[model samples]
Target: MKEKQVLIVGLGLIGASLALAIKKEHPNTRIIGLDVQKESEAFALKRGMIDEIAESLDLAAPEADVILLCSPVEAVKKQLQIISRIPLKESVILSDAGSTKSEIVDLAETLGLENFIGGHPMAGSHKSGVTAGDERLFENAYYIFTPGKPKDQKRIKALQSLLAGTQAKFVVMSTEEHDKITGLLSHLPHVIAAGLVNQSKAFNKEHPGAGRLAAGGFRDITRIASSDPVMWTDILLSNKETLLGLLDNWRGEMDQVSEWIAAENREAIFQFFYEAKETRNQMPIHKEGVIPAFHDLFIDVPDVPGVIAEVTGIIGKANLSLINLKILETREDIFGILQLTFKRKEDLERAKECIEKETDYLWYEK
Candidate 1:
């Protein structure tokens, strides 16, 4: 097969990452990047992310077999406008990493770009810019494809083929479906997190020591509040209608909680929490939808010295590498649960065997 030329519009985290991933998997594939920031082009070039930096869209779009727009939601619209006016080859397949898909897909349709396939790789870090780009950023992540038309499968497949190096699981859905679900799953969460942080800030102003008391749960839930403010602001506004509906639903739920608290309905409150916990527990921790399933082992270990080291040593001797290790639970004079995360299921199975054979440790798959 002839090597496909991929043109990336923005050289930020996602764009630079796609470049590196493609370079790693398909070295012969030519990557052309275009960004407003000269430093980003230099950084990606220095890192061998792109074969060449297109000085302009005129230079890039015409030659590209695949065009990936990885800019902010608003900027994506502008880039689309620019690309629409450009005389490009009909074979060029355009995809985007925008958070909201409805507008982008509609814009592509309006621009008569039949080959444009809207995509969002559902993975990223709070960190931004080309410097934070990693080849494995999209590994085991969901790559959503919201095509402008149902029959644009060929173009979608070609775009996916170009992004094969990212190792993301492809999910096909309509643009409206993508927007509504993402509005709830992603955009609304950011809004809620920011609201919670603001509420905490206000409380801390009235009670100076309140800020110092935020630990574990508060910190975990609000971690996304530290995300790029400008980017999030654009996202929040872009998905305003769907987010507004979510806000109303959230308000209704909060009102129910308030009513329960006022009435002192202990059983009702307990039931509410019970149902929520049950539903949350049912959510898939390990990827099951095309993305590679995670191999995690949760072990209950005694809160004593040498026990963790002993377990780790046993696994180490078996030549199984742990991707992540976390003490899930710990308390005074109590057995703690340790969670071990691995990249491959075979490693997890090996670790399980080693644990059962070498020690009497109680463990279960996560």
Candidate 2:
């Protein structure tokens, strides 16, 4: 195989992480990076994502064997316009990290590009930017490849090899399928999260009393709404058509719940709740030999020194790793609750037994 020179056209988290994964996997291949923001370039360079940073793509386009455009969807579309007309090395295989692909694929076809591949990694955090770059972010994540037809098989093999460190299974999907499915699973969630936060705030303003009691649960659920609104707005707009379909489907379910409550159909409401619980229970277990599911185990402790310490000690002694913990310090709330995470049913049972045996703490949430 010929020695490779890879050019990463953006210095965001996705781009920098991809650079790091490629560097770790292919040390023989030199990586070049270009970003519009000077701070982003500096951060990516300091993090050692790219071996050298370029001032312009024009200066760096000629040498790359693989070129990754990891800019935003709109930005990627515009960059592809400029990139396709550039004096790129004829053998360079181009791939993109845009979340949306229909618009990008259209742009590529418009530019008459033959070796371009559309891609998305199914791992994104609420975090952003070059400073948020973590090499292991893509580890065990799914990477979807929407390769254009008539692509060189060698290029496909080379691109796949470059991403070997991601532990990402590269599944091939058409550009249209990728957009529609993602708009449902990925994009729709952001839309709903943001909308829920907005609707809650609007209701609070009208009711006024609800604002006084925005509890830990509401705060936790709405945390995704705190993510950059500009990014969410851009995604929602770019994937509007498919998102509308998802929104309508979600509304249909919401309408059923509303009708059941209005008619005082307790049986139907309880049945719906039961079905939801059952469906959630069957999810994949993150812990080996255990069912994958999210369950709430709430322990109440008095507001005193070492209360949190004493509670966690029982959990640790019982050998259960807490996945997430939050302490609420709001006034008028007497006891603090600890929501523990355990992979196995055995661990949950053990922790419950240990707490019941060793401590006088009250279990409030099941």
Candidate 3:
């Protein structure tokens, strides 16, 4: 039997990642990439991610056993056009990495792809482009699939087989459920982040020193707002029904907060915070769980120039491996917290001890 062929369309982070992942997990599959950017195609080839790179989908589509559509949420229409135009000899599994599922799933249904599933991996960084691609990005992330039809189960399994190496948890949900749940947990938060950044900027414009006071808390909360604006706008609009409903609920909650503050009800304010904190404490979330590493060192340092460089220098001198570091503040008044993850737990401990000896920063191992 001939080896299976997987065609990946688009060569951005997600597409490049899918190509690398599928090639790694299912080495038997012949991976081929179709990218609009010829330079990206050449890069993918040089990286050995794909067996070959096609200049167009017209040349690659018909030969693929599976088509991984990795276009942005806003480009679902163009993806549908490409899928619809493909002339596969056999029924090929068509799947995507689009964030909002309802619209894309509906479009896929209309386009007549036999085995269409809309997938959204709850994994990403505040970065884009081919260079940001990592095969392990989906590890431990929730990969949701919205099946086009009941008969697409086999195709779903096939996709799962290819991703088995990533160790992601597979979740099957209806398009509506996927949109509503993701909008509440994922989409709504991004909107709030953007709103917060805007509010902070406006405040800084009026009160000149206000921006200087915002420390780690502000940057941590507003980080998601730095993501691709066009992509987020497309997602928010695409899932308007779910997002608007969430926004309405959030508005009511905000009103309650405002009302309590206006009344000068300290007890009510405390109660609101206590209850919210208790709720958050129950969630299966950790500081390093989503964005940070599982085994990491966290430090609280007084916000000062050259403090980060000094700490990193200490750790580097110790020869400890650093996986990634997040600097939570860029201001001078307030102290900053440094969250560092290491490749090994031993390195984490070594880095922690080394950094602790250098600065007045208190350290905690998380």
Clashing pairs in 1: none
User: How much is 14 displaced in model 1, in angstroms?
Assistant: 0.8
Q: Considering every candidate listed, which one attains the maximal lDDT?
A: 1
All candidates in order of TM-score, best leading:
3, 1, 2
Identify the runs in model 1 with alpha carbons over 4 angstroms from their true place: 1-3, 288-366
Per-model C-alpha RMSD:
4.2, 5.4, 3.9
- lDDT per residue for candidate 3 within 135-164, as digits (tens), equals 876776778889976647887898899878
Give residue 3's error in model 2 in angstroms: 4.0
Residue-level lDDT of model 1, residues 237-313, one tens digit each, is 88888988999999999999999999999999999999999999998776533223446789999999888899899
Q: Distance from true position, residue 197, model 1, in Å?
A: 1.4
Pairwise TM-score winner, candidates 1 and 3: 3
Candidate 2: global Cα-lDDT?
0.77
Q: Which candidate gets the maximum TM-score versus the true structure?
A: 3
Residues 25-140 of candidate 2: C-alpha lDDT, one tens digit per residue: 87888889999999898877787888889868877887788889988887888888888878887777998988888888777978988878888876655468888776766655
- Name the lDDT value of residue 253 in candidate 2: 93
lDDT of 1 at 346: 67
Range of the 10 consecutive residues with the lowest summed lDDT in candidate 2: 286-295
* TM-score computed on alpha carbons, candidate 3: 0.85
* lDDT rank order: 1, 3, 2
| Cand. 2 TM to true fold | 0.80
Q: lDDT score of model 3?
A: 0.78
Over 4 Å off, model 2? 150-153, 207-209, 286-302, 306-325, 328-335, 339-366
